[model samples]
Target: MKPQKKKYIFHPKVIKNYRGNPDLLRIHLTPEYTKVDFGYVAKDIYINGGWIRIAPETFIENKITKQRYTLVNAENIPIAPMHHYFETKKDWRYFSLIFPPIPQNDCLLNIIEVKNGTPNDFNYYNIELKMADGIELF
Candidate 1:
């Protein structure tokens, strides 16, 4: 039997074009360019000091084998602001929007839009969390 591939879970609440506009809500996932990959080994997005942080997942070592493995907490899974690429612009080709799993907390995210360009080319789409009343957390 073939090894099962790990499935990535996306949060329902995703803010697209999420740069300083809280009311301008777009569809969570767009098919235009949804196959972009960010080469993240093992990381989780969390709110810290009014900013979204992408860091390595905490893992516990196995006593017998002494091997480190990622802990399966709620944070280990990838949430909203999934992956997307834009084909409209001539110069830019790929970009991504990442969101944390925990939506209830006062979260802040820096939308790092990586544009495929020469030498050094990239853009940032900073997004701040603003939860609506009665919005359920995932």
Candidate 2:
């Protein structure tokens, strides 16, 4: 029999405070890779409508061990220097980033996307890896 791979899924409840205001949807931890999903709603065209990109320097840091997992790949999102422009004020985008598997014991984490002290930085802090009610693992 094939060995079963261990997998963990987390739906973060922590609020994201940033200019882009991307909503973190889910976090998937597997033996091979850690995947993070995010949703970006296009609203307030005059204020926040524009383009968004995932910087190459983006990472997921374990709050306790301080171990950092650098981004390995991205889906439905463009890497930095390349922008994903909004077609309309109502246009929204869902994207995911993949990184090396996070250690199972590191329950708390932070997702940082280029920390430059700017208003448009997409940084989420203190993300607890726990399953939220109604989020089923498939």
Candidate 3:
């Protein structure tokens, strides 16, 4: 069996963009860029900081740059499952939210936390993403 990756508290942070670089959230992609894998989390959110315990309509976008990052449900899982993405390992709930390729590489990921039925009831949190030059990821 392969070595198991240690499970730690999942704190959602942009480790890097498509390009293989640290402290930068820039993406270097070709025209065929459909989706980009953010170095935030591969799977299994432990209902902690990165992953919210309560399922809220969350989306990442930069209000300053006015760019909206689309949330793509890559996994065809049920909408009502407590375990949203990875297998139920912890007692807390988990889920995944795949985002399409960011339009601009040098942009901050603004997480827009929204409430059910109440659009006014929402919060915005910036994930301190890199706003430097994007690295080519084609």
Top candidate on lDDT is 2
lDDT by residue (1-138, candidate 1, tens digit) is 333222222232433332322222321222121111222211112222122212234222223334433322222223223322222322122123333222222333332223332222122233333333223323
lDDT of 3 by residue, 14-78 (tens): 53333222121222233323232222232233433222222234456765787666554533323
- Kindly indicate the candidate among 2 and 3 with the higher lDDT: 2
Give all candidates' CA lDDT scores: 0.27, 0.80, 0.37
TM-score for each prediction? 0.23, 0.85, 0.39
lDDT of 2: 0.80
Q: What would the C-alpha RMSD of candidate 1 be, to one decimal place?
A: 15.8
lDDT of 1 at 56: 32
**Model 1 ranges off by over 4 Å:** 1-24, 27-103, 115-122, 133-138
Error of 2 at 7 (Å): 1.1
Candidate 3: misplaced stretches above 4 Å?
Answer: 1-57, 74-94, 113-124, 131-138
State the RMSD for candidate 3: 12.5
Quick one: ranking by TM-score, best first?
2, 3, 1
Residue-by-residue lDDT tens digits, candidate 2, 46-112: 5456777899889999888888999999999999889888877778899999999876553788899
